[model samples]
Target: MTETLVVDASIAVKWVVEEEGTPLALGLRHGRRFAAPELLIVECANILWKKVQRGEVSREEAKMAASLLERSDIELFGMRGLLAKATVLATDIGHPAYDCMYVCLAMSRNCRFVTADERLVRVLHQKAPREIANLCVTLEQLSAGSD
Candidate 1:
């Protein structure tokens, strides 16, 4: 199997929608496998819904993005089995469980967890147990060889 990296909704959203760090975010896709909690899909849908509401994208464009994401090569893991662990990590790190799921996945696989949420990074730096904190990285950090 290709070497794997864990990605969260924040990073995945940029794959379909142009935004800051988008180029770097797209770079992470090259020759590497990505894994994430199945909640990734719902999170992407929720983002698209918000984009449509804010007029950032057309309804048709949002649908197209959603379709493309569904067919993307990302590997999705069911969140049910992950819930309790994720919840504990979230509580321990003072971050949302949704974001913690990506970190947990990365920890399990011994790979980097890439996300666009710098707030999560700050929180991890401030509160995440060192082991898990070391697993979280921003898209730019991973892309620029700084991770």
Candidate 2:
């Protein structure tokens, strides 16, 4: 069976940016299923915008990135059903509620929330409930799994 991962913007951005884990994140595309809240679109767009602002990516590259993401096979979950749980989780973890939405969705779907945000991982590793911690895996962990 294919593993379903709930990826946040950090992981998603790697798909377009030639970062350290870009290949690993790309590896997931073939045999795994990816999911995230609709919030991912906005978060990814903002990241792309920032990259453009920093001159790390040209406007044309950002547009291409956005187009590619729009065509990617990621399953997007709506925020309505996730809001309440996400809010409570955010409060509990002291992380932003936006990020918690991905965690909440992963919990609801009984899947892992894969992220590249080290601070978020560390915070959850130190303070989140064991259940929540168990639902998250870093990009490095996911990469190691293929070997």
Using all chains and alpha carbons, the TM-scores for the candidates as numbered come to 0.94, 0.94
Task: Provide the lDDT at 136 for model 1.
Answer: 79
Superposed Cα deviation of residue 125, candidate 2 (Å): 1.8
Give a tens-digit lDDT track for model 2, residues 1-147. Answer: 998999998888889877678998887777889999999999999999999999999999999999988988899999999999989988988889998999999999999988888788778878899898888878887778721
lDDT of each: 0.86, 0.88
Clashing pairs in 2: none
Return the TM-score for candidate 2, rounded to 2 decimals.
0.94
Worst 10 residues of 1 by lDDT: 138-147
**Collision count for each candidate, in order:** 0, 0
In terms of TM-score, how similar is model 1 to the real structure? 0.94
Which ten-residue region of model 2 has the weakest summed lDDT? 138-147
RMSD of each predicted structure: 1.3, 1.7
